[model samples]
Target chain A: MSELSTAAAVFISIGVAFDLIGGLGLIRLPDIYNRLQAATKCVTLGTCFILIGVLIQFGFTSIGVKAILCLAFILMTSPTAAHAISKGSHDFGIKLWEGSVVDKLAEDKSKE
Target chain B: MMKKMLFHFLMLFGVWLLFTWTLEIPDVIAGVIVSLILAVLLNSIFDGEVTSLLNPVKLFWAIIYIPVFFYHMMVANLDVAYRVLNPGLPIKPGIVKVKTKLKSDLGKTTLANSITLTPGTLTVDIKGEYLYIHWINVLSDNVEEATKEIVDKFEKYIVRFYG
Candidate 1:
């Protein structure tokens, strides 16, 4: 195999590993918020790496440019989606893990 | 107002061009229609030159910020990996309120998203000038201290970009 495809293969494998780790985190984490932390961070980074691998393989061709666009869209949107989920879940009364330390939002609500 | 609208139209057109990557007459026509609609809708939302993002200086800062953000992301990913894999399951999860001085909506949104994107921290809510952050490790409970740790890294560039 050529060096470029080899590099791409390496990146793709690492990305897949990260995605798997994120899935594991969901099962191991004790609460919804913690699970979100895993799914959002790991999976988004993993997907980006995969897209970057695609970019490396395709260069600046049409497909590569499309991959760049996909990367940008995922990078921008996923974190915001996670934020909304975290906030919405908290507001909807999803409980934090037993070991968690604080709840500033609930505290603020109580003050008001 | 018309000139500003035109400016946004051109900017969106450039993005549309990039996304489509074709000079065929049909696609170009569709790109024009879509970009026109998008630019107008976005203009209505921002009510100005898209929150100083279109400014050359701020654009330069945004360019600089992308690499810095990616670096933080890498560190955050590694941090998450270690926490997830660690036998002890080391996470001190909590929500802490941190203050931000930015007044612009765009700036605050960018800051909130930046906090969320960074590993070990997710922005839970923003009320007034304060952001409630869900941190994996609660190193500080003091508002000023937490703000310093969380907001200081990205706020400068965001402020410059949105000013």
Candidate 2:
């Protein structure tokens, strides 16, 4: 019945949709690296959208500002963690998909 | 070094203000004091200067960068959705090294973060000027070509801010 509610609903739904697709990506993708790609993109962006919805729902209030802070925090933390995860996995010797065509990391490592 | 610390102080104070929206004198005093202490404490953790992202032009472009980044995020999400929905699940994931022309460490971090934010590509590692990226869809094997796909749009805007 209200504009704020409707907007929040829309945002939450889209966010959940993204989250679901990300889960699907985790199962469908072939390897750990690909699974990470899905998890990072889906969860970060999905959660951000949900936070944006909360922002719209509670504009300029204490909670709204908290929502903004949460968004910023997620933006800062998630990708750094992903970078670390992917690097650690690669360094730990997880093999890429058989179809994978190029690996500049191994090439450089061998050259070194 | 002093300027970067000041910048950090201002940022922390701004966040404090956001968290504590009321204008009481005690809160203001405490926020400023806390911000100063943390700024000095944290700023010294780094050996040298900060990026000093204070330029007006850079600020303007940063604001503009928001929409473009969101658009890329949406496109990437939809792309992933499509891949997931498809029965074939077409994906050609790989690690391709791409070179970035940015000179600063912050610039490099920004570029890598941007790549990771966009779906289908995750930056795995950085060695010197090269980035090892996990690409969900490897469109090309050539380094320059892959760099064009992964780094071009972001590097163009990020160069103005950090590099």
Interface RMSD of each: 0.9, 1.2
lDDT of 1 by residue, B91-157 (tens): 9999899999899877788788888878699988889988999989899988999998988989887
TM-score of 1: 0.93
Q: Which candidate is the best by lDDT?
A: 1
Per-residue accuracy of model 1 over A35-105 as CA lDDT, tens digit each: 88888999999999999999899889888999998998998899889988988998898878889898888
Task: Please tell me the TM-score of chain B in candidate 2 relative to the true structure's chain B.
Answer: 0.93
Off by over 4 Å in 1: A1-4, B41-43, B49-51
Off by over 4 Å in 2: A1-4, B47-51
> In order, what DockQ does each candidate have?
0.77, 0.78
Worst 10 residues of 2 chain A by lDDT: A1-10
Candidate 2 per-residue lDDT, tens place, B83-124, comes to: 777999788878888989998888898789889989689999
TM-score of each candidate's B chain against the true B chain: 0.89, 0.93
